[model samples]
Target: MKKYIFLIILMGFTTMGLAQNSVSGTIKNRNNETISNVEISVSDAVIQTKSNEKGQFEIKNLPIGKWILIFKKDKFEIKSEQVSIGNQEQKILDIILENEEHHIDEILVSSVFNKTQNENVVKIDHINLKQIQNAGAINLSDALATNPGVSVVSTGVSIGKPVIRGLSGNRVLTYAQGIRLENQQFGEEHGLGLNANGQESVEIIKGPASLLYGSDAMGGVLYFNPEKYAANNKTELAVNQVVNSNTQGSNSSVTVKASEEKFKFLVQNNYTTHADYKTPNGETVVNTRFIEKDFKIGTSFATSRYVADFRYNYNDLNLGLPEEEIEDSRFRTPLFPSQKIENHLLSFNQKVFFKNSKLEATAGYVFNDRKELESIDEIALFMKLKTFNYNVRYYLPDFGKFETIIGFQGMNQENRNFGEERLIPNAKIADIGFFGTSQYKFNKNLLQFGVRYDFRNVTIQEFGEFGTEGSFQKLDKNFESINASFGFKTEITEKITTRINVATGFRAPNLSELSSNGVHEGSNRYEIGNPNLKNEQNFQVDLNVDYNAEHFDFFANGFYNNINNYIFISPNGNTIDDNFVYDYLQNNAVLFGGETGIHLHLHEIDWLHMTSSYEIVIGQLNNNSSLPLLPANQWKNNFRANFDVSKNIKNSFIFLQANYTFNQNNISQFETKTNDYLLLSSGIGTDIQMNKSKFNLYLTATNLLNKEYVAHLSRLKADGIYNMGRNIVLGVNFDL
Candidate 1:
């Protein structure tokens, strides 16, 4: 594989590139008024340019094919136009944009059809780069947890599990570089191995996406889009640096990219290290430090009828488990009882364009090595997971108002243990799924539906001596399911839009859930697996409504999920070796919740913006007992202002945010209640231009009031550990 990647890179560099195609356009507003400084970009390509003072823009050196041109600017409704680059040397176009009432919608590629939010039947949230930076999130999980209906289950400040609604651990799926991320996600201590540096943006499918991504997507999907290559016939070098006050941490990265008319290449390297985090009482949390190193490379080649993309990423991480002891000295390296993980991912994607149809295929491989250390030289637990996955899709020709797609997805996986301690047996897994989906549009209504069939097989090998603490039973299980989804979107009026979606999803038991027979060190409990556990299946209904006016926008969303044979772990009222014994069980469950928000842009004070949102979720079993690991209800508010300090400084903003988590009293039998708490945050950022170069500077402060509290979903809560307090971050980014 490494040799192949090198060969591809060599081919890309040696091939002579073509630069004949070109596109030129002019922008105008509703009254035929010229609009200047409008950003223009071509979809699936790195070509970009801005309209000049005369509202005229030209982008050169383009591949011959059909492309979508996107136009975006402040206070304007984002627009897209389809353009074809044939044998012609240059293509000219004129565009008109309408004034936006609220926020602009971005084009989404994660969805089957590349459409804007207002044009799709499903409700998808787009998180842009600005949002991620303004939030001052140190990791990907922390950035995701800010969205509604999304929460994080954290182990210290390093490892975190993303929970959608009330389901986590294997139920929620994450996709990066056009492939599923497989990193032993069945364990709660496992975190997202991918970094945020090379990502363009994140798209969240807040409901059942199994119809599109197959099994393990029963909860939802987080799609991380990779950054685009450099503009045609251009080379760019960029640097980013960040510093944190509380942990005395520093994060730095460097990126280099170049592109020709037919070939492109990009590379990035990032490193981050942090000392133990401090609490409100001015005491540092013991062994709460971590270090990460990541490297990414991407290359692509394009022609009139064919396009290929290749991406590879490597990550190395070392994290410490928080202990009760408080350390006064600063230590960047982890102590004993720490975790070391390494991940490597490689993906290849290709697309062939026909007269009116297209074929797309993607193949990926993931290698994950995880280890827990008992001392400087002794390894307590070690596991290796390898996965190979592939996907192929055919886009049928659009007929009138109907469009369709057919696809096949499959994967083969293997897991093994290399340490004396065994949490689960060695296992082999296989999966195959086929799906077909269609969309129809007429007048003001859009309808979408899909169906999928999936098969999964799990095989486990017995391990350890008989009648021993680490003994496991041999088992073979096969699970099959047929899932379907339906969605309808309608424009109620010029200012109102509504969406309704119904979907069914399923998940087969993981290896640990089916074969574990020993103590789980993470939770410090003896867990016995149930071989007879059945597949967990669920049906969900979702409804969303949005109202947009001159200066105000409001949205409301609700969902209800009914699950059968839901799997959970509970104490069996027994103890072994002074450790509590827990057994995996199955029961019917239901989860229901809703999220609502309002955004107001003052009509008179155009610079001021205020937004507020509330989110809640409830999960219960057939016996009316609450499910464990559910996040408490939360309410958040933000006030922001935007202005320009001078001509050299543009897109300046400052904001203040407040989050209030309500008390969680509806606890499961094995859990305890949590008290309510409020947190405050603030940030300011601006863009500075010097000659032909641009720089972005920002400062963010989290836990502004130094509030000391523990989140309900925190794994350290059992140890009476509080979250981090009063941290300020300073960031600088520049490109040349």
Candidate 2:
């Protein structure tokens, strides 16, 4: 607690230092046209801002220093200004930002889209491409975990899903290219099939968003898009390879794109094969569970203001359970349950932006298919499950600070699990919803309201033989539920903001929770069906205070979630079938928790920089014990330094980054507590420009200390099994 208080106090003083001065300027081109994206910064802190398309920009929060503002655009002479921020009211920092159109070595694209920040919308940090490239990580989930309100824990290396506040799986909805994956339609054990290599960005909307998405989105929604759409008559290809110290093997991928005015196409291919990844103890935990190959191909067509897209993703992985459970032959023979994933999506988007009346419409179809336990005799196949979503938005900027979005969505899913004694046949479920969202800004105070209604239905077939007959069971019947949200954001000052959003959401039972009848070899558990199930509802409120200044940035957010009818498996007493059996059943409970992060950066020293970030989470089940699989309180302290190696070397620089994670100790039923440990990781990267292409090299070393520690969510069987060991990775980023 003292650590938290001291950090807060230090941040308060930083906020006080933010009230310094302001500067404004105009940037125009050689032809007297306003030039956009002219990088302008004070001193060399990289506090960068760009001129608007009209070449106008504003800067603030100067802490009384001899500041020199530098403005430079590609092919243009670099502009410079030396002035003091010390009580200078007569300072007129105005200059024309020019453009040098003569040096056209290659095509350069600019991002001209207007970015709007509305306090009423509660838009957290925008995970832009720049941030993604700077924060070297293995995947999107690991990258997004840096955000305060979001938490991520892997079911294994192959499965990592984000938890908002304290909700995930059934409570969350992930979107790509305006389409929802709908695979989380089942449960948390299943992983998302997205690769971040060719991704544009991932937006984490952390609140009750069912008003636009439907029942599957009780917690929030995550949006993913392509990095860049190639222009007509152009082609871009990128190849990436990554190696990590924790996992000795390297993963490689390639993405090729060709686009034109009427049509844009992209093809992405990825392959990763790892041997037994070692832990600090020099032993392997997750067996052949490592993945070998995955592929994804996508294409898009745009005309006027309308766009259409299609995508397909496939995964082939040889999976295995923990060494402790190796006695279970079910996973040894059927070739250790080789798993495959196939996903297909199709969608269309149209926009009408005329006058103050703006209309946007989107519709899409998604299919998530998985062949569970396919390598085993008693195969449990989850066939093609489908989902359909649609939305319509109308914006009226002329209405002042008032905006509204409304839409309707419907989803239907089917699952089948077979066995020799009896074929469970299949289970079918559906969700239909209607919702609305409104935002209003008054003075410095902002407000937003949302509401949603969902109808759920589920049916199961209980057959006796392979094709034998049994009475059909309506496990979960038609259920009606509602979700609502209201929030407020207030800018206490030009540099400080406080925001809070309170919402309620609900989720009806899914197929897996209702009629799963066979063994899940991956989890090494034989799951049964539950005929009696109820809807789970939750009401949560989040409070955040953010402060940004000349040399500091900090935010603290707290959330409380009250959940009821939590569908957790109960004790099925005891049962011995053809093989040694485990006991489990189904029951209901309540849950609550919250997550927060605090980051601080020390003043820079020459080419060196120091920064630290801390994250902690606490939660309970029935308001009693901890929530299983919840990420423990941890912290990452990082130090980086970059230096100019030489001038003739051109793009020459060396950077070193080191990070450490603190202890995590929350454990639930049947789970053990894990001890804390430290990790040291470092990386160096550079790029070499060529005549027609570019080559980049990246080398990273992880677990430098070889410290042994186990993540609370690591799929490895208990006893504090070491999770990572010293390893080095080498990769090349080639662009053609």
Candidate 3:
């Protein structure tokens, strides 16, 4: 590890060279008239400038390479263009903006090449902070469910996990602040444990991304981009508040930031408290309340040749377990059978710029403490996890029309338990990987490909027997794998584009799946691990087509995945201390799915918009049996109108939405079918100007029709409990 660290630093220093690049642009309207006061920003760089009265803007001291420029202004659609800069060369660009009547395309930062939405080889979804706030989501998982090809598997409202393409748990990877999150995610009841208040935007990769992020990315990746610092020589402050009726919950947050020419800093704090959520029948689920507190701080320093950033985040959660009956109280304090989780994370990122290339490095450390209580004053289980990760990437000099990247990533983790009940024994894990990827563009067609190799080692400590359960013996395992991918994107016609990709991914068995020999408290079952389990491998193919016209947009995405040695738990027709006995097993499986959507805007009534989307997925074992916890087919439709109530009340809009979930009869033998249901919801939002401050106000209603329904993926469904319903939310945000 020390040698690797030294090598990375040496490479950064050796690649240093001197170069000066500048970009100048003129912004105009559809009528070819120069427009002023447009905000222009360069991607992955700390340069932002506004257009002068002559509609001209210039950014200097930039790296000599390809860059994406974004132009934005009020009442105008956003525009992005790709530009390349040579050493000591001044590039000039002309940009045109249309009226804010059509949906604007966003640039995807998570892609290997930082391509635009229409140019990416794989489908990526973007959800901005503004949209998350408008939806009035209480957690990260709920906020992400608004996008197609995404769903939430929940033990309850406070314990929801993200499911993508019929895969959850360790199959999906979550990244925040450019670091992979590892908080004992092998359990079904483990939530994301991330706060959405301080995030700028969330990007979802819809398919396997093992080439970029080594393991645990077989399903996809959820990248949470932090909010950027204030513009140069500026200071800003903001506060937000939200209230929910169903849970009697309140969320409050505050943020402050300042930036100068060479340095910038930001800080944020958030607090949330809620009571038991109520169902459509006005029945309160016992022990369903939760409380959370979060704090984050970040700072950065930038020079002509180097940039360094440091960030720290702290989160504390008191989540209640909605299992057996307890007190039906509306207080914030959790009752018995609850959980307390505290997480601390620190990360440092560095970038060294050369004349034609750049080197990036990131190091992160995370500490997680989890405690579960079965009695009011006694702890049932306690586990502590500590992880250190490092990543280094070198961008090779631009090769004519090609871009190349070589990277190395590694992680070291330790897990220990100090409780009466041991779900998983003490374990240590280490991983290292090396990969290289490249992109080549010719005319309107782009080609992308990559390959990676990874090695992992795991060691477990033996533990004593518990009651009648067998003892767990010491184990050591080593795994190695190689994966690759190929993709292509092209514009089929002036108004249509298509992308095709094929990728292979793999995952090693988690400690819980290989070491556990007792009853799992979260799932209420006796799970016996398979000590000799092998690694799981998958291969997937994806196809996406998009059509963009003057007044409408349409998209279609399809995917098929095949897996070998897929591990799952099945009942063994036995019981241990009244809990059903389940054994970890492996089988070959196949999953196929697709999502389709369309957005329409009326040309005559520019303020009127309509959207409709449908998604379905099927997961089956080699024996023709359905997989467990598969999401049902769902369809969503929305109608919205935007208008100005008055000069002070600008950007006013109201929307009505409907969600239809079809009956899920395709299930495993241990699962039950869920009935079909339709849910109605609506919301209204507007901007209010008071003195020198602008405030955003929104009101949203969910499950407005009060339909009593249970989602097929809800963990509480087995207990005959319905999901939350008839929720009313009100929120206010403002900058100071």
Candidate 4:
């Protein structure tokens, strides 16, 4: 495993060069004056310091234990505190600063039953980083398809994927910095090859988390949270640009960061290109062009009780495939039933602090390379997936209000195939998991529970030409699972809040559903696989409600799962080279969903704002049919206003949005029936500055009335195409 990830990153930089912890502080305000250059940081270490000019500040090789001390300056009000350090320690503190008016509600760590509670019971959905830089989305499932029971299942515009609530791909599960993202996601045209530039937020867990991430999370989990550095003796630089106009596309990125208090680093690079999109009756669509290149790097080190992190990512893709092209140029090249993907990822994380418990370790590696081509010098399917993952967690020392966690996770996978069609063979996979979770707090409620156990093994290596059903002779498989969960959160009055949860999940049947036999060139069918498919089992129940106030905000969520064998594919009336033959079946299923939202914030027009959301889902089966790539029934709305035309422009806004969708006729069995749409979008933005740099423009449009649609999780909607229409994006971002 790459020399065991380089001997655990050289023993965490040789224990950060013989540790020596330190933390010192002094910032003031609230009329106590003395706040000098502020900016002090230390959460997830990489240290940082500033305060100077008599406001003192010090940060030296820290890592002993709990930490979170952040305080910025410029108009103040970004404060944080939670400190602890020991062993060769030097600690001193005092800080206070508060002035940046309102807007603070963010802190969610993918809640596996409360990470210091910010409301939980398993309903986490956030997407910050300024809403992904004001949604100029071109990836990360198009910025997570604008939240709310998410959806996206494209096969164009750079291949998308992500559809929670009515499953998708390998049953959804993606976690970036905290590992668990093995690339070849059981292909429905792949694509989630990680790159949403150095994200600093995105957390979602809609249902079933398999007792905290095990076995494809049974349709949920998307976490990605990385990007943090540059706060103390900072150094940062940034540049971004994007433009699209219905896929004449473009995107560019660059970022750099540096920090010191105990080392920190970040670097990012991105490049994307697009073409061949257009369709609002204006045709184009041929080949559905795409191209991308991404790069990332991260580093960290600390010392109070040790902390370490390291990350690396590299991706390259060139996908184009919308067969039967009628060529209307704008080519970004990939021609001939194309696809070429390359991904590499590495991760290392560590932490150890014990005074009240804490120990975490993570290791990951993934290298996926897939290729498919049909004509330009034929290749046809080339798969290569290698994954090695590990995780360990412990935090059991808080017995005042009770809290505990224990974990272990594992994976080692391999899949190989080289060209000339081989749908699935050459495989070796192993996984292990063990878990325990707990949390408790009385008074205002909060209670949670957990248990998990899992084990899987798959081994296959056989070739064709012997008694042929595409021959597959050598195979071994074993799967075991057990899962559980329970949760509750309260505070039912003072502006209401509630949550409830129950969970259980599992999935084990992927090697293309246990060893497929032939032809599956990305859904042209002719597949077959089902080594007695069993082990799908899932169960879920969730409910949530909230009602914060200051100027309104509401939410609601609901869920129901239930799966049991559930693994589908269908179509057995036969047809061969001409495609159509499918198999892999198992039944019993059910899915139900809900989401609701409201935001408001008018209070006598304080810069007008409004919001709305709605969603629904229903998957069925146990003979009641319906459930094949489902997703429809949605609603969204927005209004927004907020302005400030002067002071060099400052955070302005203007919005208007509406989305509708609804009309899917619940399909299954060869599915067909789409129809309904309703788009409309708008945008505007601001933030200028000029003397010390800070730009950030924006402009958006998107289908504004050019409507001709087609989306019901469009995998090109079974070949009737039509989905991209009016676009118009434009973006800019700066800081140097």
RMSD of each: 3.3, 12.4, 2.3, 23.3
Residue 535 lDDT (model 2): 74
The pairs that clash in candidate 2 are: 27-97, 28-97, 232-260, 245-727, 570-585, 572-584
lDDT of 4 by residue, 7-123 (tens): 464355343335577788688888888888686755544566777788988887776666667676654556767777766778888887865442334353556533433545566
lDDT of 4: 0.79
Stretches of candidate 1 above 4 Å error? 1-23, 29-38, 44-67, 84-91, 98-101, 325-330
> What is the per-residue lDDT of model 2 for residues 1-736, given as tens digits with 9 covering 90 to 100?
3223422432232112223356777877656777775767543221345677778766644334444677766446556676655432335566764433221111111100111333234544456543344444554576677665566756445556787766677777787766667764455455667666666666676765555666656677777755555534468888877775555556788888886545667788877655555777777654545554666676654322223455565555444434445433322222344445566666655444333344555566677665555345644445556666555555444346666666665655565543332223366766667777777778888788878788877766655443112223445467779888888889899767888888887777666566555554545455565556667777777787767654455666666666676666543554324322233332343444444443343445334445555555566665566666666655555555544444322333344444445455566666776666666777676667676587777666666777777766666545456665777767777889
lDDT of 3: 0.85
Q: Model 1, residue 9: what's the lDDT?
A: 39
Model 1, 98-167: lDDT tens digits are 9765653656456877676777898998877546766688777888888888899997678888888888
In Å, residue 336's CA in model 3 sits off its true spot by 1.2
How high is the lDDT of residue 326 in model 3? 80
Q: TM-score each candidate.
A: 0.94, 0.76, 0.95, 0.33
**RMSD of candidate 4 to true structure, Å:** 23.3
Worst 10 residues of 1 by lDDT: 9-18
